[model samples]
Target: MESLEQKSSIARFLDNVFKLSENNTTVKTEILAGVTTFMTMAYILVVNANILGEAGMDKPAVFVATALSAFVGSLVMGLVANYPIACAPGMGLNAFFTYTVVIQMNHTWQFALCAVFIEGIIFILLTLTNVREAIIDCIPPLLKHAVTAGIGLFIAFIGMINTGLVKVGGAAVTLGSMRDPLVLLTVVGLIIAAILMSKNVKGAFLLAMIITSALGMVSGLITIPKGIISAVPSIEPVFMKAFSVSTSEIFSFDMVVVVFTFLFVNLFDTVGCLVGVASKGNLLNADGTLPRAKQALLADAIGTTAGAVLGVSTVSSYVESSAGISQGGRTGLTATTTGILFLASLFFAPIFTAIPAQATGPILILVGVLMASSVLQLNFSDPTDAIPAFLTFVMMPLSYSIANGIMFGMISYTILKLVTGQKEKVNKALIIISILFVCKFIFL
Candidate 1:
């Protein structure tokens, strides 16, 4: 009788840990959804290490910090938002850190860290004042579609680089030879994704990824080095280090500009991602307010601050979370599950390191394709809408900045309406945003 009682107790504990409520479908769907989202954006966890590793940080330190920030940030986002979205160091911000701050500006990593923290604080203030909502509301609807599609293109570009289907050059980049096996595999993956999406397959992105990866392995396009599949042990806590910034550099106008730029990009990126994913999740009511927008924003801000303290770049929410919601995730449980997986990753860096970029690259490309479909929802009948949508969509991939694309689109829309005798259609909030965009570009 004692043995049976003990067994039942353990079972109950497991259920709670997994949050297996009466709705079994919800639990299973959430878990699968989280896992799928994790797979899509998992590269961020390692990309930071690669960037910092090139700049003299030890591999172990990078791994520890990356894993810790991702786990903590994701957990907070899950717990606070009660939404399944995951947070991590953003891709574009990391590029800014490595290329702009470190390389071009010749600043130390510590100063960049300071900038991240400062920006995070600013973001927190914006969220608290509900200023974020005003900024979001000011975005022309056409630009929103473009921003989404642009992100899709940006993500696809990353995947192409990872899979070696594209390479940078001195004056221009070049696409890889179509005959390469890896390239062929990526094409196959795209085809698979398209077919799955057309068929309305559940977890279509995940399914296409699995299929492509398996085919890549079988075709000898994906080579896994020995010991890459094995898991390492868990991580231990280290002493908290103080954040340091050199006053001489921190006070410089150039430094301030760089830091603010990072802050601005991350702020908009996070806001855009939240709007996109929340819309898909049905988290927002008829009113624009999301159920737990404050909680979600707080989590993102905290994550960015934590990431900076840990010697990385700004962290933010990912649009890839939409993949999970599209698969039926409706609660923070999915985010929690993804957080646990990220924590588990600290010990299992080898498992992640072992997976060739080619294996995962196809997955991101598939996600990008899925995300781009939102463009179709834009109201193209109105020239005001059509013009801005075209500008935003084209500028995203061309300018390589979603924020810039949005700003240009908005400015153009406002200008066109004013010149065409439709000035009454313009909102005061949008005019303010456009003015700010112009001033920031010219003066700042």
Candidate 2:
């Protein structure tokens, strides 16, 4: 009886802190959403480590850094911003850090880390000045809806590629072999998710993932980890290493380009995720702007800076957070749950890392379906709005870059509006961003 009271008291505290009642979500739902989000994106812990390891960084240390940075980023996003977004070392940015900065530019990993640190500092300044918030607000409503839908398709494409359900071919992409166990598992998982969703099952995404993993094991499609817990890896090698670079090295032309690339890509990518996820969760206000937008942007900036200090690439928001929002994660408690899981992953690395992509791929695809509903909100009657919105969403999956999608959408929107005598409709922020994007293509 005493233990039950303690449990009830803790639950009430969490409810009050997260404002669960106001958000129309229960503690159980938020926790399930968090677990769902973490499970889908857990691959980052290993993927980031492997990519950075190519640059001569210690893999074990990078793994620890990835987990810790995610923990810090997600925790702040939830506790401070009160949003259900998660952050980690981003995918494309990590590739650029390894291939462009470390290899092609002939700079050490430490130099790349310094560049990330500098870019992050700039992001913080932009957020404080309301620059980032203004950009998010100034996005045309049509394009904002398009971004939400586009990210949906983008993540679904990711799910297909990750699970080997599709592959790059002579033309663009081709179907994978039916004989492949992972592909077969993905098919089964999708079917299960479809059924669960149709039935309006609570925690459908989480349940589908668990059931899919179990099936994979039974079918020998996934190898279970031998042990669940391990000692936390040391992060000493990468910790504070960004400070080792000299000012001259950081001020070099190559480093300047690297920093700009990081800044540009992270800026829009984070914007896309924030807008896309918020739209899907109905977190945006009646005017289509997110409340506390500065706090959200600041969380991302802080994550990037802290990630660089801890020896990782640019840390930004992840679209995979949609998996949680779709599961009814309306508040920061979802993000806090994911953050705690990341912290726990340090000790249970083996178990968390063993979750197969095939298991989570189905959830992402289902999330894509949920988010694509935003397309219905678009004003398809207006050619100017329709064309830009079309390009905004189509380019995301085709180019495999959220930043590229936003760039195309913004540039086209500006030109069309100017030529069609709709200049009054386009705000100064959108115009400036479009011009900067054009300059980025020409110069950078």
Candidate 3:
């Protein structure tokens, strides 16, 4: 039997490990959420490295930049917002950087980085002036719900593609057979995750991934290469690469359009993510505002700037972090824990690399399902509400972009209400957003 002093010391140690403050439950929940969120997104480190390497960056540079940006950005976001959120170079934006900016526009990666930097600065100014908040407020509640749900579907689709359960096609996309070992393993992971979640299991996402990964290795579904696992320790430092461009060069008409497009897309995406995660974490105040929202926006803008300096695309808060929030995370402690994990990944990239997509894919799907729950918050009794909500939700996955879904939904809602002689219900901010959406689609 331990003495009283020894027991007290042990309790203190456990509290620290779990990040238990005076509100021990909230801290434990946040820590668990952070771990799940980390597991869901661990693939980004590997995926970004591959994408950047293919785009001519050194592998070590890509690894270092990704790790640093993820850790630093997340830390700043947490510190500023006091919310359990994480930021990184977003996946879609990076693809746009690689394919559209570099390949299609025939620009150097450095030039693309300049575009991202300029956009970040613009976003910072917009946030400071309350333009971002105004735009977010303009978005109808139903449309926001749809955007959230659409993002959830988009994430799940990406997970499917990563696990090789879905593939691009000549005519149309199609699903792969379950006979594929990777597919089978992914299904098993999904089953495990679902079962665990149903049982109110702790660490459901992480546990499912670990179990599925181990089974894959043992069943010869995932091959482990020697020496590769040890190479993660060799990842080198990535120096900040400043974007160099003349004002005239960046302010060209074409470049201006690109910058504006990036700003608009990135702003809405960030807003949608903040709303979704805030709702899940119950972080919003009575007035429907998240505490320190401006600070959160500041961190987001700063992160985007940091990513550009590190030679990546726009950085934004990831909805995947909601995976942690849904699991009971409610404080900056969870964000800090996630930041630490990202930093640790620099030396464990190989271990992360060894994780087959089949293992982590289920976690992404689970997160998508969890996030999609916002649809339940929408009021469907009124046709005025239901139509817009349905349009937004349907358009998200079908249109394959959040902006498109939002634009169409808003236009339809405004027109429907106006035609029915209910124009009084329309807000001026909504009108401005709708007009901007139209102009963006038509001219820009």
Candidate achieving the largest lDDT? 2
| RMSD to native, candidate 3 | 3.5
The residue-by-residue lDDT of candidate 1 on 79-168, one tens digit each, is: 777778888777777788777887787877666777888887788788789887677766655566666776677667777877778877
Question: Clashes in model 2: which pairs?
Answer: none
lDDT of 1 at 81: 71
Instruction: Estimate, for each residue in 1-444, the C-alpha lDDT of model 2 and write its tens digit.
Output: 999999999889988888898999998999999999999999999999999999999999999999989999999999989999988899999999999889988999999999999999999999999999999999988889999999999999999999999898869999989899889999999999999999999989889999999999888879988898899978999999999998899778888889989999999999999999999999999999989899999999999999999999999999999999999999999999999999999999989998999999998998998888889999889898999999999999999999999999999999999999998999888898899999999998
**What TM-score number comes out for model 3?**
0.89
Stretches of model 3 off by over 4 angstroms after superposition: 1-24, 169-171, 225-238, 246-248
In model 2, which runs have C-alpha deviations exceeding 4 angstroms? none
lDDT of each: 0.72, 0.94, 0.75
Model 1 misplaced stretches (Cα beyond 4 Å)? 1-25, 166-175, 192-204, 218-220, 228-242, 287-291
By TM-score, who's the top model here?
A: 2
RMSD of 1: 4.0
| Model 3: per-residue Cα lDDT over 52-98, one tens digit each | 66556666777767777888778888666666888888877777777
lDDT of 3: 0.75
